[model samples]
Target: MTSSPAVTAPAERVRPLELFFDLVFVFTITQVAGVLTAAPTVDGLGRTVALLAIIWWMYGGYAWLTNALDLARPGPRLLLLTGMAAYFVMSLAVPRFFDEGPFGLILGLAYLAVVLVHTAGFIGTSGHRGISRLGPLNIVSALIVVAAGIVPPQARTWVLLGAVALEALSPVIAGIGGFAIGAGHFVERHGLALIILLGESIIAVGTVASELGDVLRVVVGSVLALVVSAGVWWVYFEREERDSERLLDAMPPQRRGRAALLSFGYAYLAMITGVTMAAVGMKKAVTYFTTPLHDFELWLLPLGLALYLAGLAAFHRALAPVWEWTRLVAAVAVLLCVPAGLLAGGWLMLLVAGLVLAGVVVVSRTPGLNET
Candidate 1:
């Protein structure tokens, strides 16, 4: 009888250097928040989403890369430091990415460098069959960003969007056969990323609250935003995380890669989108406390909450391979409540959304609440 090779899980603890490396990603998130603060229009919104999509893909690549390799080695360690430098430069350039100027080229090239380091570096070392295919595919995708610099602004936007779309689909397209996942590290990394995003949401609410003339609105809105943020923390952290990690740990080695790709990579994209949009809405709500919400503002918070719930549901489905329709119903309730929510000021809107979120957490505790 022939024996199959053993599958090894990487260390469960996330390293200090990994946390330090994520500091740059936090900076990137703040930069994204600032971009919206700078230009709060439909077009600006598009730009922010495009930039964030690119940044998220780049950041996600690093998580996968580190999970695959022993980064304590001098070669991998140095390579990661080099990538951090690139990320820092990318952050500096993000504010001007849409200006159709030098920053476009700088941002494109910097991202290209990150893509190269993660893909080419790994492929050269591991000879993994999936990565062998993924390497060339991502390099082609990265080159699209470089091409963004050469084109007109409209064309640049389209090019970068194309690149983001391509990279987002790459894992599914590649199938990642025979790839491995460090379930502990993989789960921890994504969980930490979610925490950072929620922190950013809190920062957004506070930033808006600081400038308000009304002490009441500031106090109330700040509290309400925290409630919503807390609700997000509860829903994801309460039981889902532990359960999800267990599922990931139980997955066969060959299959875990696909679940990580779909669950963390694609589904979490929606979760991040929800938080980012909610932050934007919170900022606007604070700015216009006494004023009526624009149709967009009225819809934004509900939309964000819905996306967050729906995304988490998808994430859970990926983890357990079972659809959670009750959660989907909760997502719809968030939207249904929006019209009534808009009748009140921004603070009330947040309060209403927070209630919806709290309800999700409460309802999920009951039997069949998470079932289809």
Candidate 2:
């Protein structure tokens, strides 16, 4: 009697390495927050955006790699875990890199080392099928980052930005590869990451509110932050994710793969950019009265709100065929509230946040929007 080979499932069981990978991101988040806290300027904000963009690409790439490769094997799992450890070390060095001049090169080298290790493992375990698909873009991006490290200090920023651009472009190239991309898990991980970022925003709000000590300010700010966070949650998860799941499940595998790549890998850049900046905005809102709103702080609030709104709109557009009028209106309302919030002080900012939340709740409850 001849026996058939055991078929491994495409969606592998979540492993300890995946969990450890997530822990490294916690440090990544902290490093980013620390950088924002120290610099807190317009240049600082730009730097933070560039840095987060690069880190998000790194995280997203590895995530897709894990989704594609079977990590149940000891060799693959150990290599990935080691890469994650290297990533954690790189994350730890971010604050120092930004603060101390001499340490920047050390930090850059450390970060490159992590990327090299991960890239090598990704290529090795991905097999011919997967490697042939994403290999070229991966190789291109890895080289750019490595080359960026060799540039002089004055020229490093532009080089780093170029490296980041290369990394961001990898998904577009990878999507051209016709493979069974797991849409469900991809969306799930990003959704969870969004929640984690929002949670950080809430923590920032609470901490800042506690420092205020005034009952009225604390109460007002706390409520505003909660409402804003709730509005964000309502906007994304209300029906968008469900719709995406249905759409992908119904479509052909190749098109579904492209859609999943576009939605989770590309679209999420806007969402995370907004969410991280919103954390900065919340910090500014809490401290606006004591510290005069600098040009950067002034810009952060509106920019963050705009990015968040844009991301929501993009997600809705992708999920539903018909335009979401309510979402468009909500986005406009949020943008309009920023200047008014500036004029009325921190409490007013909180009030504006509440209004935005109310809009999301109303739209979420509107007829014909319910998931099947």
Candidate 3:
């Protein structure tokens, strides 16, 4: 690794190589959606969230790493590619993660490699000391993940959740004082990741809809799905992105570290979970557009969107002192559609969510409400 200090220019934009790295995240998101569709139950949801929490923690680490070090250089560039390869291998293991197979062991080894690459990259930056302390915790977490695979299938879920909790708390225990965040690059990196996920949402919808036998139904369902996805895109990009970056840039280093962790790291995890749920919901909506949804399917569409809106509210609250009442209220309003969806169908639920999100976009853009 390069011996350069961890500092990076605050004005730096995301690099092409960073975008390439995000393609792996795209695959990971797809894998997550697949997991949800296969199980579609409370247990499946728990596994999805736990698996994503662990994966996203390390993904955020790479984003922070790129923010601190320029990957245009040969050494950092190569290591990042190595990390990408390991991440891809890890993603490959995601499909059967909770199953009784070698994938659990494979995922553990790949995750360890990813952690090591991330730590090695950080050593070249100003955050080396802090990363040195945080790195072993991540390794131990990876080992815990491996152990989850070894234990009885009935016990794997708890083991994975334990790993998730450890990694989530590790940065707090290790301290973030030494790490430097390039505000612009950090914001842009995550923004791009969100964009990738949003696109995946659409992909999930279109892919599923197209597989259905009816062309007209496919076209209609695809259009409705687009409306919902576009509304989410508008809410996030319209002002949240700018406000987050501006607030982050304006903070002192110490506060910025904590703010980034809470706002981007933790809050975005919720948002991503919401997105994955909504995507699965939309896909199911397409599958059952004419018929009423049963069981967990009925809750997926509305509740998923509700979670996204609520997460956005939390994210705004984390960055600013004020509550985002519009989003919070909208989140609740979306949930009200669950009973109606059971009586009608998922398509109606999707339509109601799209309209609610549209209202939020308009209200958010209103004169006085634009204050961040």
Candidate 4:
């Protein structure tokens, strides 16, 4: 009898290449947060989203590639390292791109080059079957990127926007086969990235509080921000991770591929969106407290909270059909507290943060919370 190829479990050990790739994402995250910080207006908000979407798509594509191929292989490892270097260049260009008129065009072109190199590497390493699967979409993406480069200055922005959309949709249209990378690795990497985002928020909050020179307020605000971050951590890592692993494992191979794509691949967009908004909100809160509440900052506070809560909701919904009442209540309470924070000033931000933590605690401890 012929022997079957060995099957690997979704919980198989993570490779070093995976970890190194994640380290590179740290720079991408930092660049994203910095861009938001530089220009925190409505127009800036749209640009930030486009930039982030492009970055996320690039990272997500490579992640899926590693999921299928053996990252320990020299070819894949080198490609990832090269992509990492390209991403760093893109990140460095972000600040200048946003600030200078001509620089934005240059940044856009640099970003396209990074995507092309990464995609080309994938195509080169991918064999006949893999190439056949990815070829058309890859061609389309490359064309879009090239087109973005040559577009008129007035139209360059929209061209780049369209390129982002094309890049984002490539995977779905490609229908590439799943590689079955360990769910644990996927979850852990994202968990670590989320921690980095929260860490950034804490750093931002601390900086703001210190500038105020009010010891009690700084201590309270810092503590509250920590609690908020903890709540976000608990909500994800506490039970959701295990449940998702179980669900993915129980699914048939074909269905599991789709599940992985939807869960790990797409859902992260919502999660990152929340983190970005929260970061902005926290910064505004600190500024509003130090000075008088500007109309814009007042709007930002609630809007940021809403985005964060919406992401939380998206995560739960994607994992399973069941919903926790405490999560619902917590989200609503956070929203309600937004106005109170505005009226009472910075203390209200702290108070809303407290409510968010309490809701997390309640949800985490709730009896008989059904697991998918």
Candidate 5:
């Protein structure tokens, strides 16, 4: 009889089941955004980011996990099923992600279950650097998330932030000695995850449109949000995703994991967070189209775009430094416009943010930005 081939499947394609598991995070991102949608305050926004970091860390594990696991086998396939179940249950608690309520406890427990599953599954696995050296650190970071739920809300934010930092930095701090990448699978997985998050923006449009009735103003606002999302898509997939994929495929095996760590693990975290934030802003803008802007509510779209751009730029810096400065400037410009957005009202501010991002996309096509 054959031994279990749960780990070290290098040539296998990403299976349909893996794609099916990804469905859960679509709702996961939405739930995080819904939390901010409800509050749209400084505190609410901070909590949303904290919650997103935790959620992203959990989702990210599978991306790296599957890159090493031989999911064609029963053991790994069942592991994924269990992880997805936990992911869905935890997503249900995302709205209360940082609230010091029973839901927080539930979210923590679910998240811990996910971490435990991955950590335990990877135990005794051979020749997987991400799982081998960095896996234990993932467990530690997840424990921080579990601890965060029990703390007061204020401290919960900091604890979650720590959890994100620890997990994101694990590659650098812990080093992925045995970590290797099946580049094709790794790239496809992360890219699909980005698409899923971008789809959240589209989902936001529909979700907002339905709530807003069929008014012309709402229609226009909805279109603008889609435009913003499309422009974001172009900025990323136009060159960045392709380049990163090429780079990962070209890298030597021993080094591939760290590069994946920097480019996909940490960088994609920023991108996913930014995309989710953009969805939150877009949803709120749907409401703001008819209503007037108040205080920080106006900041959502710009802030969202800024984070999204910043994430892109950070990845560019890590992989290809030349594009970094330009991306940074574009991100900062959006951020600088927040005060104007605060006063400009929702629809108008969204229009401004959308236009500015469109311009950034144009600039991204310049000769130098093609360095990949």
Candidate 6:
């Protein structure tokens, strides 16, 4: 009997099943935002960072799985659905992950399921032997997550931090020697994930508007938030995304996996976290535009945008010769606006961020100035 093709074909598009998986993935993002919304402090932001880093690591794993496994086969298809269900369960526990309760336990259990299914799916597929190197390390991370639930609430963060540490080490420890990347599917998966994050930012705007009594302020706030989000969208989608894809496609197979690891897996985490922080800030601004902003609210908007631009800079740096100084300069400019934003309140801060990002987009379109 002939064996099924193990890896996705280069010309193959992302399957509908993968999009369905992404829907579940976005739910996790929403839950992480909920955690930040509930507690908009430094502690809250730290928790959001920890939870999101762990969550995003696994989500990236699934994206790699789809890139390397032919989902047209029934076995791989079923495993993908199982992974999706596991993520949905993880999302359910996300909001209360740091709270002292059963939620952390739920998160741990769901996380274990996620890792096991991912490892199994990768191993089950033919010609995916490289997973043998990464799978055990992933399970070790998952077990650490389970242990995080058992620890006291104050100690959970430290335990989870251990997990994050392990995940960061997995690539270095396990190495990226034999993994294969289907360039088209891999790039499209991350791009669609970014779209989901941008959608959440837009959703936050609408959500803030929905809760407010002031129509005029709501309209103004929502429009300003869209402008900032759109400018970020243009910064990624306009040229860098296509250019990165072309570069990855042209790269040697061995190099493509590491490039995907750096650009999509690691850098996208920053972009996702930045969007979540900015969206939380946008909701606060739209809901409370008439009042002076809290310190966290004032800082979140601009700092969030700065982190996002920095992520874009890192994304380009991973693939291209230049560091994309335009984005880095824009990031620094956004950081410098904090004092100005501090004086102007949240609405004005949002406006300034939108304008700054807009300038980046416009400069990117100029011929000689756009090179890096």
Output the number of the lDDT-best candidate.
Answer: 3
Candidates 1 and 6 compared: the better one by TM-score is: 6
Give lDDT per model, in order: 0.77, 0.66, 0.85, 0.63, 0.74, 0.83
Better structure of 3 and 5 per lDDT: 3
Models 1 onward score TM values of 0.92, 0.85, 0.96, 0.83, 0.89, 0.95
Judging by lDDT, tell me the better candidate of 2 and 4.
2
In model 5, the Cα lDDT at residue 115 comes to 87
lDDT of 6 at 163: 97
TM-score of 6: 0.95
Q: Among all windows of ten consecutive residues in candidate 1, which has the lowest summed lDDT?
A: 2-11
TM-score ranking, best first: 3, 6, 1, 5, 2, 4
Ten residues in a row with the worst lDDT in model 3?
Answer: 2-11
lDDT of 1 by residue, 109-140 (tens): 98888888777546434325667778777888
When 3 and 5 are scored with TM-score, the better candidate is 3
Clashes of each: 0, 0, 2, 0, 3, 0
At residue 337, candidate 5 shows an lDDT of 50
Spell out the clash pairs found in candidate 1.
none
lDDT of 5 by residue, 187-219 (tens): 778778788778867977777787768685467
What ranges in model 6 sit over 4 Å off?
1-11, 124-127
C-alpha lDDT of residue 337 in model 2 = 47
Q: Taking the tens digit of each residue's C-alpha lDDT, what string does model 3 give over 317-371?
A: 8888988789888888888668667766757877888899999999998877744
Candidate 5 TM-score over all chains jointly? 0.89
Model 2, range 301-351, lDDT digits (tens) per residue? 556766876776666556555566666666667765467555765556656
lDDT of 6 by residue, 190-265 (tens): 8888888889779878877867757766688788888888988899999887888899989998888888889997
